[model samples]
Target chain A: MEFLSYTFMRRALLAGNMVGVIAPLVGVFLNLRRLSLIGHTLSHVALAGVALGLFLGFFPVYTAIIVSILAALAIEKLRRDYRDYAELSLAIILAAGLGLATILISASRQSAGIHSYLFGSISLVGTRDIYMILPLALVIIAVILKYYYGFFYLAFNENEAWLAGVPVRTLNVVFMVIVSVTVALAIRVVGTLLIASLITIPVAAGMQVAWSFKSTIWLSLFFSLTAVNLGLILSFYYNLAPGGTIILAGVVILLLVLLVKKIWLLLRRDL
Target chain B: MSFLKVEGVSFAYRKERVVDDVNLELKQGDFAAFIGPNGSGKSTLLKLILGYLTPTRGEITLKGQPVAEIMDWTRVGYISQQVKDFNQSFPATVREIVGSNLYSKMGLVKFLNQELEKKIYRALELVEMEDLINRKIGNLSGGQQQRVFIARLMVNDPELILLDEPLAGVDIRAQDDFYRIIGNINQEMNKTVIMVSHDIQVISKHANKIVCFEDGRAYPHCSQEFSYDDYIHDLRRTNLRIIPRHDH
Candidate 1:
């Protein structure tokens, strides 16, 4: 009870819960649209932005958010310009961001902040960080829930959606923006290296059990909440890296779901 | 005024003109079919009318208004070939797939609610897929998937429906059923339909008008008495019958 009373613990829980909710919500569509790799790419772009901010003596969060949005726009434009080879463009951007991040980190004399950003330390989460993450998470959730059908339609069949007047292109841009914001906000908790797993694995696990699209989204949210909360608690207890632990928790849950699905199928066949 | 007018339209892919010097017109509540051999510009012409591709030189008008200017796409519905361009593992139910058509009508600001749910089921019922609302789209048979796609087109309640080879790969029984459904949509709903198909026999029975494409020009055929001999000759010369089968 005393441990729960600590302000830092309360802040960490709130921040972790915020990211836990937003990542998987976006992840459901992300996984469906085969844009799961965008999360990883944007995270690395955010890291490069953070490194740049560190080099320039400014707050890394603002720089990270701006850089992520730019990266998102660049990716969207590249996809449009090179529709035939969009994946190749994504790979190029990802490589550029990662390569630049490595160079910036190596060139810097100040290594402490870079290490902190590499593997997130949730103990460093302050009130301001909570304030920044909470509203963004809320906004992302609200927007996605409000336009669930649009995203679903766009993901399921883009050409059909266009014919039916779904504003497929504009909705695509909006979706990418939401993904950029989610990745930017999630950096504090999940870090850049493993954030895609945090977004993807929970949905992968949820898909195994969910019968309908709506159920899959809800179950993904549930899995995310469980993994993030448990991962946060375990990291607190064992003095481990929070991002690494959360991702590991997600992977473990995915494995369990796959095993359960396999067993259920075998048992049904036997019966 | 014609319900739809396509004038002087020419479409090309990288300097290779696929649809050249084409003109077409459809009256209100007409059932029309576009037929051609392989690469005869049937699908390309449909794409131009649907605004998926820009005509290198021409205009398409719907209800006497330029299609590009009128952004109200609720009046236009489309079903493409059964190509399965989507991943087979995609997670969408039959109801969700059909309900997606409502998005354009309902707009982006609205959420899918009970009213939308009812409409989706009603659309499914129209195509006899009310029983399979919960089935995953990928799990259905090819015929069943075509029915679902038809249901998807139905949800919008469009005045004009364009279909690209709805019977491309289905069994004969399914094809007959599909043609019956199209007849009902045209005869009962009075919706204008323009389908691109190669089946002359089925089109002769179902469609009120037919347009055959050969050598980049469209030849309109309105009567059932038009010789299948001409079509077969065009098909042999242009080799339109050799459709590249898409791997599902």
Candidate 2:
């Protein structure tokens, strides 16, 4: 309770909670499309953006969002070009992002400045981050709700969805943008390396017990929120890294869900 | 104008022309099966109609407008070749797959109403899949999975249905059920269909006409006019083999 009174803790918790809800919400579609690594790739791109922003003496978050969205679009384009090698397209972007980030990081010589973005620091999440994260989270939630069916269809099959007039091209672009925005905002909470887990691991857990697409969405949301909040609270008490805690929580939950599913199947077999 | 028309359409992939000066016409409720040996471009023709690949020359119009510009996509349902490579562990249920196709109509509003639910059920019932509506689509047999997709198509009640090798990987036993459902869609629902199949012999039973592609040229004939010897001769003339469906 006393920890909640700290300004930095409050900001970190607020921003982290929003990400907990929306990142996994978006990840369900990403997992279906098998673009789960885009979060990690774009987080690396955001690091480069942060480096550029600091070099130019501008706000890093703004550049991070812009750069991430651009990279997301590039990933989408490359994906279409290499339709058969969709994962190869991601690997290309990841390599490019890492190379660019490494170069820019060394050029700026702001080694210490980049530390918080790499693995996350709750004390570094400012009031501005909360304000930005909160509204973006709400907008993403609303948009996802509005276009839920279209996303599911596209995720299931892109070419069929296009012919059926799901605005496949537009929706694909929009979804990539949404994912990039979420990743950019989430980096502050879970850091560049761990945000991918925030988006994917809860989804992995949800699929273990899901009966349908709707159930998968609900179950993933539940596990995601649980992991992020629990991770944040534990990090606060133990003075541990928030990003590590959130990701570890997600991994643990996925394993537990898998174990439970195994036990339940065994029980059914015995019965 | 016909229900669907492919007028002077020709398409090329990079250096090679895949579809050449192919023209086709279908009235409402006509079942035309595209049959040909491998590399003859039957699937390419289907792609043209779906506007997945635009013609390098000429036009493809559905209901009088270019297919790419057709405003009401719900009027057309498609089961693509990718259905063969379907992710068997996909976590969606039959109901979601069927109902999600009606998304264009459910625009702006987020929830599915009673009417929408009824349509989904009716679609499932038409495919004899209503009992398994809540079942995960991945858990269904190949034939049942095909029916679920058909039900997904039927939910929109589209006028024109395009199926490109819908039974490509389906077990031989389940294939009979697949044809029965397609038969119902054609006869009872009176929907126009364009199906690409390797077995001209089997599909000729259902198709009113057979459009055979030989060396990028299309030859349309009445189903009764099709001869096995003629088809084999056409393949020989083009220096092509009588390709089995699985031979790429």
Task: Using lDDT, give the best candidate's number.
Answer: 2
lDDT of 1 by residue, A28-83 (tens): 99998888888889999989888887777777777888888999999999988897
The lDDT per prediction is 0.83, 0.86
lDDT of 2 by residue, B174-222 (tens): 8888888888889887899999987776788888878988778888884
Which residue pairs come into collision in candidate 1?
A: B37-B240, B38-B240
What's the i-RMS for candidate 2 in angstroms? 1.4
| Docking class for candidate 1 | medium
Can you write out model 1's per-residue Cα lDDT over B1-248, one digit (the tens) per residue? 89999999998888888989998899978999888676888888887887777789999998888777767676777778834577667777888778777775564464666888898888888888899999998899888888888888788788789999878778989898898888888989888999988877668788888898776678787445456676677667864454433441
Candidate DockQ scores, in order: 0.60, 0.63
The lowest-lDDT stretch of 10 consecutive residues in candidate 1 chain B is B239-248
Give the backbone clash total of model 2.
Answer: 0
* Candidate 2: docking tier: medium
For all candidates, what are the clash counts? 2, 0
